[model samples]
Target: MKIEIGKDFPKFFKPLYQEEFELFSHFETTAGIPTVLFAITTWKENGKPNVCFHSWSCFHGDKTAFFAVMGNLYQHTHTYTNIQREKCFCINFLPISYYDKLIDTIHQNDLETDEFEVGNFTLSQANVIHAPIIQEAFINMECTLKEVQDLSGAGITAMIIGKVEHISVDEKYAQGYERYGKDGFMMLIPAPQNILTGEPNQSAIASVNIEKYD
Candidate 1:
């Protein structure tokens, strides 16, 4: 049997009317949301350091980037408050070797806990900013806050835009950059998945070669 809906058929017609979909649930069905995991470091007004794992981030322009932080949804969160006061941060791009540490840091909720000490990571001073960069990371970007935009009407989430002032790469990775033939010398990019249960799928690391087009 063959059935075809012609042009006369209504575009809104559905076989099941009760099967309504919800917003933000498309993460389960879609793929290819590149997750570049990094540690956002900031300093408090009292000279204390704070760090947190941020997977949702992207480049906005040649020298600008943005990351979404849900600090407005909760009180006493150090990442938002610290950035608000300091107006600068360092994004340290983590490699696969730091996967365990990243997971451990994500589970930590104490605002007073220093992630560098807890994750067994070292901090290196940024050249252009006061924020400390993760010494173990392969790449670091020192950025100054440029703008803040409300992502949601209820103020659940806000986007933090920053202008990258300086960038640093490890020496080994720097050599690998020219050769493009180093083993395990790539950044870790996880696949998007359910945020609550941390289940239903496995994450992946993405690495690709650049192909120039004419």
Candidate 2:
């Protein structure tokens, strides 16, 4: 199916900004970019674990990375405080299938309760970090906060980028016994008449194995 070009995202090709230029190459990362869902639950005065998660783009094709904070620090946010105190967080690249559940979690829920428990998602300890990982997430990117730079320019969110250390995936997405990209891996195929036609353009999100293109 030909993706008819309707009204283009007017902002896609606008004038260049310093912030846009810095992160221009993020689209070409070699890692499986799971729109990260950050869960905060420590509840520290400085490190209060707040159960707040959002969709953040993966950076540098690295599994372990920091939350997407590409502007200024906010005045009151459970996410910010959690990042400030904990210094380490887990990046669960949730599939688009869990969109509704994630959206509900992002929306203001209970102040003292965790969405993980409320949402009925399996709660597991991070392999190398101190954050919670949604067991249902196909590929989990465990990130350790390395640096918090203040990119307070015109109107940008402070960038909270970090480095990756360890990563884990579901057995279904794993190849053989130790490698990623198994038969059950989900994939998201772009709409193309050369491939998909009248049939449902169904694709698997977790099936995108990084080893295939290599």
Candidate 3:
């Protein structure tokens, strides 16, 4: 037997359908999807450095990238405010070993404490940007702020686009870079579930083959 519930469906089920729709929307938006994470570094007017973890970042063009910062939550964050003042920042691609520290930086709210000290990470001077790069990171991009879009009206966030000035990669990972596009990079990403605790996981690295069809 086959039953079709079209526009003529009973009114009694309308509320149930609406409730399920909202739940689906929430889950789709908030579900922990795997994304490449970067630690962005900015410098204050006094030359103090601040770092923030951002998973909502991606390459925008051949020499540009964009990232979103939660305006409502990080309105007073040093990294957000500093970037506005300095107009430059560094994006550091951290390894899986720093996953725990990266999570800690996200939750930390103290503006006075430098993230490098708090996370126990060393910083090196960037060749083109005032902001320093993480010494331990395998890759670092020095960028200048190209644009800042106010997305607060739609969602309490701001989209920051930057022009990549320079890119530094560890020599070990740089060998035969053309052969391996992104698979050669070793970085942490969100996991579907924890293997040990069965909780929402956070750190995992996987490689996938790129298939092209003409």
Off by over 4 Å in 2: 1-51, 61-75, 153-156, 176-214
Candidate 1: TM-score? 0.68
Global lDDT of model 3: 0.62
lDDT of each: 0.61, 0.50, 0.62
TM-score sort, best first: 1, 3, 2
Candidate 2, 1-214: lDDT as tens digits: 5533233322233323344324433221222244333343334343323455443444575344434332233425666667677786666655445556655766645557566766567877878878777788766766677767655453334466656667788776566432333333223332221211222222124434454452
RMSD of 3: 8.0
Residue 32, model 1, lDDT: 32
Candidate with best TM-score: 1
Residue 144 in candidate 1 has what lDDT?
Answer: 90
Better-scoring candidate (lDDT), 2 or 3:
3
For candidate 1, list the clashing residue pairs, or say none.
Answer: none
